[model samples]
Target: MTHGNTSWQEFGQTFVDQSRELNQKVTDEILERTERALVSAKEKIKQTEEVNEILKLRVEKAEQEARDVKALLSRPMREIAEISGDFQKAYEQQQQILANWILSQKAYRETAVQLGIAVGKTAEEVQDLVTQNANAVLENRTEHGNDSNTNPLVKEYASTILAIRKKNGEV
Candidate 1:
Protein backbone atom coordinates (compact mmCIF):
# COMPACT_ATOMS: atom_id res chain seq x y z
CA MET A 1 0.00 0.00 0.00
CA THR A 2 2.94 2.45 0.62
CA HIS A 3 4.47 1.71 -2.79
CA GLY A 4 1.14 2.29 -4.57
CA ASN A 5 0.65 5.64 -2.73
CA THR A 6 4.14 6.83 -3.75
CA SER A 7 3.44 6.03 -7.46
CA TRP A 8 0.13 7.93 -7.34
CA GLN A 9 1.88 11.03 -5.90
CA GLU A 10 4.55 11.01 -8.64
CA PHE A 11 1.81 10.82 -11.36
CA GLY A 12 0.01 13.83 -9.90
CA GLN A 13 3.20 15.98 -9.80
CA THR A 14 3.99 15.17 -13.48
CA PHE A 15 0.48 16.17 -14.55
CA VAL A 16 0.79 19.58 -12.81
CA ASP A 17 4.23 20.30 -14.42
CA GLN A 18 2.89 19.51 -17.92
CA SER A 19 -0.10 21.84 -17.43
CA ARG A 20 2.19 24.70 -16.34
CA GLU A 21 4.45 24.18 -19.37
CA LEU A 22 1.42 24.28 -21.74
CA ASN A 23 0.17 27.55 -20.08
CA GLN A 24 3.60 29.19 -20.60
CA LYS A 25 3.64 28.28 -24.34
CA VAL A 26 0.13 29.75 -24.86
CA THR A 27 1.07 32.96 -23.02
CA ASP A 28 4.20 33.46 -25.22
CA GLU A 29 2.12 33.07 -28.42
CA ILE A 30 -0.47 35.62 -27.20
CA LEU A 31 2.26 38.16 -26.34
CA GLU A 32 3.93 37.79 -29.81
CA ARG A 33 0.56 38.28 -31.66
CA THR A 34 -0.23 41.39 -29.59
CA GLU A 35 3.18 42.95 -30.43
CA ARG A 36 2.64 42.33 -34.20
CA ALA A 37 -0.84 43.95 -34.06
CA LEU A 38 0.55 47.07 -32.37
CA VAL A 39 3.29 47.46 -35.02
CA SER A 40 0.71 47.24 -37.82
CA ALA A 41 -1.48 49.90 -36.19
CA LYS A 42 1.45 52.30 -35.91
CA GLU A 43 2.33 51.86 -39.59
CA LYS A 44 -1.27 52.61 -40.61
CA ILE A 45 -1.30 55.78 -38.52
CA LYS A 46 1.91 57.07 -40.13
CA GLN A 47 0.52 56.44 -43.64
CA THR A 48 -2.69 58.29 -42.78
CA GLU A 49 -0.70 61.35 -41.59
CA GLU A 50 1.33 61.45 -44.83
CA VAL A 51 -1.84 61.29 -46.94
CA ASN A 52 -3.43 64.10 -44.90
CA GLU A 53 -0.43 66.39 -45.50
CA ILE A 54 -0.63 65.84 -49.26
CA LEU A 55 -4.37 66.57 -49.26
CA LYS A 56 -3.81 69.82 -47.32
CA LEU A 57 -1.28 71.08 -49.86
CA ARG A 58 -3.60 70.28 -52.73
CA VAL A 59 -6.47 72.15 -51.07
CA GLU A 60 -4.33 75.27 -50.56
CA LYS A 61 -3.27 75.33 -54.23
CA ALA A 62 -6.87 74.99 -55.41
CA GLU A 63 -8.01 77.86 -53.15
CA GLN A 64 -5.30 80.21 -54.45
CA GLU A 65 -6.25 79.50 -58.05
CA ALA A 66 -9.88 80.24 -57.29
CA ARG A 67 -8.98 83.63 -55.81
CA ASP A 68 -6.86 84.56 -58.82
CA VAL A 69 -9.70 83.70 -61.18
CA LYS A 70 -12.15 85.75 -59.13
CA ALA A 71 -9.92 88.81 -59.26
CA LEU A 72 -9.58 88.60 -63.04
CA LEU A 73 -13.34 88.31 -63.45
CA SER A 74 -14.04 91.37 -61.28
CA ARG A 75 -12.10 93.90 -63.41
CA PRO A 76 -13.86 96.10 -65.98
CA MET A 77 -13.46 95.14 -69.62
CA ARG A 78 -12.91 97.74 -72.39
CA GLU A 79 -15.27 97.86 -75.35
CA ILE A 80 -14.00 97.38 -78.90
CA ALA A 81 -15.45 100.70 -80.09
CA GLU A 82 -13.79 102.67 -77.31
CA ILE A 83 -10.40 101.17 -78.07
CA SER A 84 -10.86 101.82 -81.78
CA GLY A 85 -11.79 105.45 -81.16
CA ASP A 86 -8.70 105.98 -79.05
CA PHE A 87 -6.50 104.56 -81.80
CA GLN A 88 -8.14 106.82 -84.38
CA LYS A 89 -7.57 109.91 -82.27
CA ALA A 90 -3.89 109.03 -81.86
CA TYR A 91 -3.54 108.47 -85.62
CA GLU A 92 -5.16 111.80 -86.46
CA GLN A 93 -2.89 113.67 -84.05
CA GLN A 94 0.19 112.02 -85.54
CA GLN A 95 -0.96 112.92 -89.07
CA GLN A 96 -1.48 116.56 -88.11
CA ILE A 97 2.01 116.75 -86.56
CA LEU A 98 3.50 115.23 -89.73
CA ALA A 99 1.66 117.76 -91.96
CA ASN A 100 2.91 120.67 -89.88
CA TRP A 101 6.50 119.38 -90.09
CA ILE A 102 6.24 119.01 -93.89
CA LEU A 103 4.93 122.56 -94.30
CA SER A 104 7.67 124.00 -92.05
CA GLN A 105 10.41 122.15 -93.95
CA LYS A 106 9.07 123.41 -97.29
CA ALA A 107 9.01 127.01 -96.07
CA TYR A 108 12.56 126.66 -94.67
CA ARG A 109 13.81 125.34 -98.04
CA GLU A 110 12.30 128.22 -100.01
CA THR A 111 13.64 130.84 -97.59
CA ALA A 112 17.11 129.23 -97.62
CA VAL A 113 17.17 129.34 -101.44
CA GLN A 114 16.20 133.00 -101.47
CA LEU A 115 18.95 133.76 -98.97
CA GLY A 116 21.50 131.88 -101.14
CA ILE A 117 20.47 133.99 -104.16
CA ALA A 118 20.78 137.21 -102.14
CA VAL A 119 24.26 136.26 -100.82
CA GLY A 120 25.60 134.88 -104.16
CA LYS A 121 25.97 131.32 -102.71
CA THR A 122 25.47 128.24 -104.95
CA ALA A 123 22.44 125.99 -104.35
CA GLU A 124 24.72 123.08 -103.28
CA GLU A 125 26.47 125.28 -100.69
CA VAL A 126 23.10 126.37 -99.30
CA GLN A 127 21.92 122.74 -99.10
CA ASP A 128 25.14 121.73 -97.21
CA LEU A 129 24.71 124.59 -94.77
CA VAL A 130 21.08 123.57 -94.13
CA THR A 131 22.09 119.94 -93.54
CA GLN A 132 24.81 120.97 -91.04
CA ASN A 133 22.36 123.16 -89.16
CA ALA A 134 19.76 120.38 -89.05
CA ASN A 135 22.32 117.89 -87.74
CA ALA A 136 23.41 120.26 -84.95
CA VAL A 137 19.79 120.84 -83.93
CA LEU A 138 19.10 117.12 -83.82
CA GLU A 139 22.15 116.41 -81.65
CA ASN A 140 21.28 119.17 -79.22
CA ARG A 141 17.65 118.10 -79.01
CA THR A 142 18.62 114.48 -78.38
CA GLU A 143 21.04 115.47 -75.61
CA HIS A 144 18.65 117.94 -73.94
CA GLY A 145 14.90 118.08 -74.69
CA ASN A 146 12.81 118.51 -77.86
CA ASP A 147 10.66 121.33 -76.50
CA SER A 148 11.51 123.98 -79.12
CA ASN A 149 11.06 124.01 -82.92
CA THR A 150 13.99 126.38 -83.61
CA ASN A 151 17.56 126.74 -82.25
CA PRO A 152 19.77 129.81 -81.71
CA LEU A 153 21.91 128.95 -84.78
CA VAL A 154 18.84 128.86 -87.01
CA LYS A 155 17.61 132.18 -85.58
CA GLU A 156 21.00 133.79 -86.15
CA TYR A 157 21.15 132.52 -89.73
CA ALA A 158 17.65 133.84 -90.44
CA SER A 159 18.51 137.25 -88.95
CA THR A 160 21.77 137.46 -90.88
CA ILE A 161 20.06 136.53 -94.17
CA LEU A 162 17.29 139.06 -93.50
CA ALA A 163 19.87 141.80 -92.86
CA ILE A 164 21.85 140.90 -95.98
CA ARG A 165 18.68 140.96 -98.10
CA LYS A 166 17.58 144.25 -96.58
CA LYS A 167 21.01 145.87 -97.25
CA ASN A 168 20.87 144.65 -100.86
CA GLY A 169 17.38 146.15 -101.20
CA GLU A 170 16.02 142.73 -102.23
CA VAL A 171 13.62 142.29 -99.24
Candidate 2:
Protein backbone atom coordinates (compact mmCIF):
# COMPACT_ATOMS: atom_id res chain seq x y z
CA MET A 1 0.00 0.00 0.00
CA THR A 2 2.76 2.47 0.86
CA HIS A 3 4.42 1.90 -2.50
CA GLY A 4 1.18 2.49 -4.46
CA ASN A 5 0.45 5.78 -2.55
CA THR A 6 3.93 7.18 -3.35
CA SER A 7 3.54 6.38 -7.07
CA TRP A 8 0.12 8.13 -7.20
CA GLN A 9 1.60 11.25 -5.41
CA GLU A 10 4.45 11.45 -8.00
CA PHE A 11 1.97 11.32 -10.89
CA GLY A 12 -0.10 14.11 -9.36
CA GLN A 13 3.04 16.31 -8.92
CA THR A 14 4.03 15.80 -12.65
CA PHE A 15 0.56 16.81 -13.85
CA VAL A 16 0.71 20.09 -11.79
CA ASP A 17 4.18 20.90 -13.22
CA GLN A 18 3.10 20.38 -16.84
CA SER A 19 -0.04 22.56 -16.33
CA ARG A 20 2.11 25.46 -14.93
CA GLU A 21 4.53 25.23 -17.87
CA LEU A 22 1.68 25.41 -20.42
CA ASN A 23 0.12 28.42 -18.63
CA GLN A 24 3.48 30.27 -18.76
CA LYS A 25 3.84 29.64 -22.51
CA VAL A 26 0.34 30.94 -23.26
CA THR A 27 1.01 34.10 -21.23
CA ASP A 28 4.25 34.78 -23.17
CA GLU A 29 2.53 34.39 -26.54
CA ILE A 30 -0.28 36.76 -25.55
CA LEU A 31 2.31 39.40 -24.36
CA GLU A 32 4.30 39.14 -27.65
CA ARG A 33 1.15 39.60 -29.79
CA THR A 34 0.10 42.66 -27.70
CA GLU A 35 3.55 44.27 -28.23
CA ARG A 36 3.33 43.80 -32.01
CA ALA A 37 -0.12 45.43 -32.12
CA LEU A 38 1.15 48.43 -30.13
CA VAL A 39 4.09 48.93 -32.53
CA SER A 40 1.80 48.88 -35.59
CA ALA A 41 -0.55 51.43 -33.99
CA LYS A 42 2.37 53.79 -33.31
CA GLU A 43 3.56 53.58 -36.93
CA LYS A 44 0.11 54.43 -38.22
CA ILE A 45 -0.04 57.51 -35.99
CA LYS A 46 3.36 58.76 -37.23
CA GLN A 47 2.39 58.42 -40.90
CA THR A 48 -0.86 60.32 -40.30
CA GLU A 49 1.03 63.20 -38.69
CA GLU A 50 3.44 63.45 -41.64
CA VAL A 51 0.62 63.57 -44.14
CA ASN A 52 -1.14 66.31 -42.17
CA GLU A 53 1.98 68.47 -42.18
CA ILE A 54 2.40 68.14 -45.93
CA LEU A 55 -1.22 69.09 -46.52
CA LYS A 56 -0.84 72.19 -44.34
CA LEU A 57 2.16 73.38 -46.35
CA ARG A 58 0.34 72.86 -49.63
CA VAL A 59 -2.62 74.89 -48.39
CA GLU A 60 -0.32 77.76 -47.46
CA LYS A 61 1.37 77.72 -50.89
CA ALA A 62 -1.96 77.84 -52.69
CA GLU A 63 -3.08 80.81 -50.64
CA GLN A 64 0.10 82.70 -51.46
CA GLU A 65 -0.34 82.04 -55.18
CA ALA A 66 -3.88 83.36 -55.05
CA ARG A 67 -2.66 86.58 -53.44
CA ASP A 68 0.07 86.99 -56.06
CA VAL A 69 -2.39 86.60 -58.92
CA LYS A 70 -4.70 89.23 -57.43
CA ALA A 71 -1.83 91.68 -57.07
CA LEU A 72 -0.74 91.16 -60.68
CA LEU A 73 -4.23 91.73 -62.08
CA SER A 74 -4.91 94.96 -60.17
CA ARG A 75 -2.81 97.22 -62.37
CA PRO A 76 -4.31 96.03 -65.64
CA MET A 77 -7.81 96.42 -64.24
CA ARG A 78 -7.09 100.03 -63.29
CA GLU A 79 -5.56 100.75 -66.70
CA ILE A 80 -8.61 99.40 -68.48
CA ALA A 81 -10.89 101.68 -66.46
CA GLU A 82 -8.72 104.72 -67.27
CA ILE A 83 -8.69 103.90 -70.98
CA SER A 84 -12.47 103.55 -71.01
CA GLY A 85 -12.85 107.01 -69.47
CA ASP A 86 -10.48 108.57 -72.02
CA PHE A 87 -12.35 106.95 -74.90
CA GLN A 88 -15.64 108.35 -73.62
CA LYS A 89 -14.16 111.87 -73.47
CA ALA A 90 -12.79 111.63 -77.00
CA TYR A 91 -16.11 110.33 -78.33
CA GLU A 92 -18.01 113.22 -76.72
CA GLN A 93 -15.62 115.79 -78.24
CA GLN A 94 -16.04 114.30 -81.72
CA GLN A 95 -19.82 114.24 -81.34
CA GLN A 96 -19.91 117.94 -80.42
CA ILE A 97 -17.73 118.89 -83.41
CA LEU A 98 -20.00 116.95 -85.74
CA ALA A 99 -23.12 118.64 -84.30
CA ASN A 100 -21.66 122.14 -84.84
CA TRP A 101 -20.64 121.29 -88.41
CA ILE A 102 -24.18 120.07 -89.24
CA LEU A 103 -25.74 123.25 -87.83
CA SER A 104 -23.40 125.49 -89.86
CA GLN A 105 -24.15 123.60 -93.07
CA LYS A 106 -27.94 123.93 -92.50
CA ALA A 107 -27.68 127.69 -91.91
CA TYR A 108 -25.53 128.22 -95.00
CA ARG A 109 -27.97 126.32 -97.23
CA GLU A 110 -30.96 128.35 -95.93
CA THR A 111 -29.13 131.69 -96.47
CA ALA A 112 -28.11 130.74 -99.99
CA VAL A 113 -31.70 129.87 -100.89
CA GLN A 114 -32.99 133.13 -99.40
CA LEU A 115 -30.48 135.26 -101.27
CA GLY A 116 -31.30 133.51 -104.57
CA ILE A 117 -35.04 134.11 -104.00
CA ALA A 118 -34.44 137.85 -103.28
CA VAL A 119 -32.58 138.31 -106.59
CA GLY A 120 -35.91 138.65 -108.44
CA LYS A 121 -35.64 135.28 -110.27
CA THR A 122 -38.25 132.51 -110.59
CA ALA A 123 -37.94 129.60 -108.17
CA GLU A 124 -36.77 127.26 -110.96
CA GLU A 125 -34.21 129.72 -112.25
CA VAL A 126 -32.90 130.33 -108.76
CA GLN A 127 -32.70 126.60 -108.23
CA ASP A 128 -30.67 126.24 -111.43
CA LEU A 129 -28.34 129.06 -110.40
CA VAL A 130 -27.85 127.45 -107.00
CA THR A 131 -27.07 124.12 -108.67
CA GLN A 132 -24.51 125.79 -110.99
CA ASN A 133 -22.92 127.63 -108.06
CA ALA A 134 -22.71 124.40 -106.04
CA ASN A 135 -21.02 122.64 -109.00
CA ALA A 136 -18.53 125.50 -109.36
CA VAL A 137 -17.77 125.32 -105.63
CA LEU A 138 -17.15 121.55 -105.95
CA GLU A 139 -14.83 122.13 -108.94
CA ASN A 140 -12.89 124.74 -106.98
CA ARG A 141 -12.72 122.36 -104.00
CA THR A 142 -11.32 119.56 -106.17
CA GLU A 143 -8.88 121.86 -107.95
CA HIS A 144 -7.55 123.28 -104.73
CA GLY A 145 -7.36 119.73 -103.26
CA ASN A 146 -9.28 120.90 -100.22
CA ASP A 147 -10.58 118.06 -98.00
CA SER A 148 -12.71 120.31 -95.69
CA ASN A 149 -15.61 120.47 -98.16
CA THR A 150 -15.29 116.87 -99.28
CA ASN A 151 -17.34 115.41 -96.47
CA PRO A 152 -19.85 112.63 -97.19
CA LEU A 153 -22.87 114.93 -96.60
CA VAL A 154 -21.56 117.63 -99.02
CA LYS A 155 -20.80 115.02 -101.70
CA GLU A 156 -24.24 113.50 -101.22
CA TYR A 157 -26.00 116.87 -101.69
CA ALA A 158 -23.99 117.62 -104.86
CA SER A 159 -24.69 114.20 -106.31
CA THR A 160 -28.43 114.62 -105.64
CA ILE A 161 -28.56 117.90 -107.60
CA LEU A 162 -26.59 116.41 -110.49
CA ALA A 163 -28.91 113.44 -110.63
CA ILE A 164 -32.00 115.69 -110.68
CA ARG A 165 -30.63 117.83 -113.50
CA LYS A 166 -29.68 114.81 -115.60
CA LYS A 167 -33.06 113.23 -115.11
CA ASN A 168 -34.76 116.38 -116.35
CA GLY A 169 -32.52 116.46 -119.45
CA GLU A 170 -31.05 119.74 -118.21
CA VAL A 171 -27.51 118.50 -117.64
Candidate 3:
Protein backbone atom coordinates (compact mmCIF):
# COMPACT_ATOMS: atom_id res chain seq x y z
CA MET A 1 0.00 0.00 0.00
CA THR A 2 2.83 2.53 0.85
CA HIS A 3 4.61 1.85 -2.48
CA GLY A 4 1.42 2.44 -4.53
CA ASN A 5 0.68 5.75 -2.70
CA THR A 6 4.27 6.96 -3.39
CA SER A 7 3.95 6.14 -7.14
CA TRP A 8 0.65 8.02 -7.35
CA GLN A 9 2.17 11.09 -5.65
CA GLU A 10 5.10 11.08 -8.15
CA PHE A 11 2.67 10.78 -11.10
CA GLY A 12 0.57 13.72 -9.79
CA GLN A 13 3.70 15.89 -9.36
CA THR A 14 4.89 15.20 -12.96
CA PHE A 15 1.47 16.06 -14.40
CA VAL A 16 1.31 19.38 -12.45
CA ASP A 17 4.82 20.33 -13.62
CA GLN A 18 3.91 19.61 -17.28
CA SER A 19 0.74 21.71 -17.04
CA ARG A 20 2.68 24.67 -15.56
CA GLU A 21 5.30 24.45 -18.33
CA LEU A 22 2.56 24.51 -21.03
CA ASN A 23 0.85 27.55 -19.43
CA GLN A 24 4.19 29.46 -19.30
CA LYS A 25 4.79 28.79 -23.02
CA VAL A 26 1.32 30.09 -23.97
CA THR A 27 1.82 33.30 -21.90
CA ASP A 28 5.22 33.92 -23.53
CA GLU A 29 3.68 33.55 -27.04
CA ILE A 30 0.89 36.04 -26.24
CA LEU A 31 3.36 38.58 -24.85
CA GLU A 32 5.58 38.27 -27.96
CA ARG A 33 2.62 38.80 -30.36
CA THR A 34 1.42 41.85 -28.39
CA GLU A 35 4.93 43.34 -28.55
CA ARG A 36 5.11 42.86 -32.35
CA ALA A 37 1.67 44.45 -32.84
CA LEU A 38 2.68 47.45 -30.69
CA VAL A 39 5.88 47.92 -32.73
CA SER A 40 3.97 47.81 -36.03
CA ALA A 41 1.42 50.35 -34.78
CA LYS A 42 4.20 52.68 -33.67
CA GLU A 43 5.88 52.53 -37.12
CA LYS A 44 2.62 53.28 -38.93
CA ILE A 45 2.00 56.33 -36.74
CA LYS A 46 5.53 57.62 -37.40
CA GLN A 47 5.10 57.27 -41.17
CA THR A 48 1.77 59.10 -41.06
CA GLU A 49 3.28 62.00 -39.11
CA GLU A 50 6.14 62.30 -41.60
CA VAL A 51 3.70 62.37 -44.53
CA ASN A 52 1.62 65.08 -42.85
CA GLU A 53 4.67 67.23 -42.28
CA ILE A 54 5.74 66.90 -45.90
CA LEU A 55 2.26 67.85 -47.11
CA LYS A 56 2.25 70.91 -44.85
CA LEU A 57 5.54 72.14 -46.29
CA ARG A 58 4.32 71.63 -49.85
CA VAL A 59 1.16 73.63 -49.20
CA GLU A 60 3.16 76.48 -47.75
CA LYS A 61 5.47 76.58 -50.76
CA ALA A 62 2.52 76.61 -53.15
CA GLU A 63 0.88 79.49 -51.33
CA GLN A 64 4.09 81.51 -51.46
CA GLU A 65 4.44 80.88 -55.17
CA ALA A 66 0.86 82.00 -55.76
CA ARG A 67 1.53 85.26 -53.95
CA ASP A 68 4.69 85.83 -56.00
CA VAL A 69 2.79 85.26 -59.24
CA LYS A 70 0.09 87.71 -58.22
CA ALA A 71 2.68 90.36 -57.41
CA LEU A 72 4.38 89.85 -60.77
CA LEU A 73 1.08 90.14 -62.67
CA SER A 74 -0.02 93.33 -60.86
CA ARG A 75 2.87 95.45 -62.19
CA PRO A 76 2.18 94.55 -65.84
CA MET A 77 -1.57 95.13 -65.41
CA ARG A 78 -0.98 98.62 -64.01
CA GLU A 79 1.47 99.42 -66.82
CA ILE A 80 -1.06 98.27 -69.44
CA ALA A 81 -3.73 100.51 -67.91
CA GLU A 82 -1.41 103.51 -68.01
CA ILE A 83 -0.49 102.79 -71.65
CA SER A 84 -4.18 102.58 -72.60
CA GLY A 85 -4.87 105.95 -70.97
CA ASP A 86 -1.96 107.54 -72.85
CA PHE A 87 -3.27 106.14 -76.16
CA GLN A 88 -6.75 107.53 -75.50
CA LYS A 89 -5.32 110.98 -74.73
CA ALA A 90 -3.21 110.94 -77.92
CA TYR A 91 -6.27 110.00 -80.04
CA GLU A 92 -8.37 112.81 -78.56
CA GLN A 93 -5.61 115.33 -79.27
CA GLN A 94 -5.26 114.12 -82.86
CA GLN A 95 -9.02 114.52 -83.44
CA GLN A 96 -8.93 118.04 -82.04
CA ILE A 97 -6.02 118.95 -84.34
CA LEU A 98 -7.94 117.68 -87.41
CA ALA A 99 -11.04 119.71 -86.45
CA ASN A 100 -9.02 122.92 -86.03
CA TRP A 101 -7.18 122.45 -89.35
CA ILE A 102 -10.48 122.07 -91.20
CA LEU A 103 -11.94 125.21 -89.58
CA SER A 104 -8.85 127.29 -90.35
CA GLN A 105 -8.89 126.22 -94.01
CA LYS A 106 -12.58 127.22 -94.32
CA ALA A 107 -11.99 130.69 -92.77
CA TYR A 108 -9.04 131.33 -95.08
CA ARG A 109 -11.09 130.38 -98.15
CA GLU A 110 -13.95 132.68 -97.14
CA THR A 111 -11.61 135.62 -96.60
CA ALA A 112 -10.02 135.13 -100.03
CA VAL A 113 -13.45 135.01 -101.72
CA GLN A 114 -14.59 138.27 -100.04
CA LEU A 115 -11.46 140.21 -101.08
CA GLY A 116 -12.02 139.31 -104.81
CA ILE A 117 -8.50 140.33 -106.01
CA ALA A 118 -7.50 137.62 -108.47
CA VAL A 119 -8.89 134.56 -106.67
CA GLY A 120 -6.74 132.11 -108.65
CA LYS A 121 -3.42 133.73 -107.64
CA THR A 122 -4.61 134.06 -104.03
CA ALA A 123 -5.67 130.42 -103.90
CA GLU A 124 -2.35 129.19 -105.32
CA GLU A 125 -0.39 131.33 -102.83
CA VAL A 126 -2.54 130.12 -99.94
CA GLN A 127 -2.07 126.49 -100.99
CA ASP A 128 1.71 126.99 -101.06
CA LEU A 129 1.67 128.59 -97.61
CA VAL A 130 -0.43 125.77 -96.19
CA THR A 131 1.87 123.11 -97.60
CA GLN A 132 4.94 124.86 -96.14
CA ASN A 133 3.21 125.26 -92.77
CA ALA A 134 2.23 121.57 -92.68
CA ASN A 135 5.80 120.50 -93.41
CA ALA A 136 7.13 122.79 -90.64
CA VAL A 137 4.62 121.39 -88.12
CA LEU A 138 5.55 117.79 -89.01
CA GLU A 139 9.24 118.56 -88.59
CA ASN A 140 8.64 120.16 -85.21
CA ARG A 141 6.47 117.28 -84.03
CA THR A 142 9.16 114.78 -85.04
CA GLU A 143 11.88 116.81 -83.34
CA HIS A 144 9.92 116.89 -80.03
CA GLY A 145 8.65 113.34 -80.30
CA ASN A 146 8.69 112.79 -76.54
CA ASP A 147 6.22 115.60 -75.76
CA SER A 148 2.90 113.95 -74.90
CA ASN A 149 1.18 116.98 -73.34
CA THR A 150 -1.20 119.00 -75.55
CA ASN A 151 -0.07 122.50 -76.62
CA PRO A 152 -2.14 125.39 -75.20
CA LEU A 153 -2.34 127.16 -78.57
CA VAL A 154 -3.44 123.97 -80.27
CA LYS A 155 -6.09 123.42 -77.59
CA GLU A 156 -7.42 126.97 -78.01
CA TYR A 157 -7.68 126.59 -81.78
CA ALA A 158 -9.45 123.24 -81.31
CA SER A 159 -11.96 124.76 -78.90
CA THR A 160 -12.74 127.62 -81.32
CA ILE A 161 -13.38 125.16 -84.16
CA LEU A 162 -15.57 123.00 -81.94
CA ALA A 163 -17.64 126.05 -81.00
CA ILE A 164 -18.02 127.07 -84.63
CA ARG A 165 -19.04 123.56 -85.64
CA LYS A 166 -21.58 123.42 -82.86
CA LYS A 167 -23.11 126.71 -83.99
CA ASN A 168 -23.35 125.44 -87.55
CA GLY A 169 -24.65 122.01 -86.50
CA GLU A 170 -21.77 120.51 -88.45
CA VAL A 171 -20.23 118.37 -85.66
Each prediction's whole-model lDDT (CA): 0.71, 0.72, 0.67
Off by over 4 Å in 2: 1-8, 77-171
lDDT tens digits by residue: candidate 3, 1-171: 245657767877888999999999999999999999999999999999999999999999999999986775577544544556765576667768888999997888767654544655566666555544444443344344422124656544655554564577544
* Between candidates 2 and 3, the lDDT winner: 2
Candidate 2 lDDT over residue span 1-171, tens digit each: 235557767877878888899989999999999899999989989999999999999999999989976765566544544556765576667778989989998887777777767887666776686566656655444445543256677665766666676788655
Total clashing pairs for each candidate:
0, 0, 0
- Candidate order by decreasing TM-score: 1, 3, 2
User: Model 2 TM-score?
Assistant: 0.39
lDDT of 3 at 136: 43
Sorted by lDDT (best first), the order is 2, 1, 3
What stretches of model 1 exceed 4 Å from their correct place? 1-6, 77-171
lDDT of 1 by residue, 19-71 (tens): 89989999989999999998999999999999999999999999998997676
Between candidates 1 and 3, name the one with more favorable lDDT. Answer: 1
Q: What C-alpha RMSD separates each model from the true structure?
A: 16.4, 16.7, 15.7
Badly placed stretches (over 4 Å) of model 3 are 1-8, 78-171
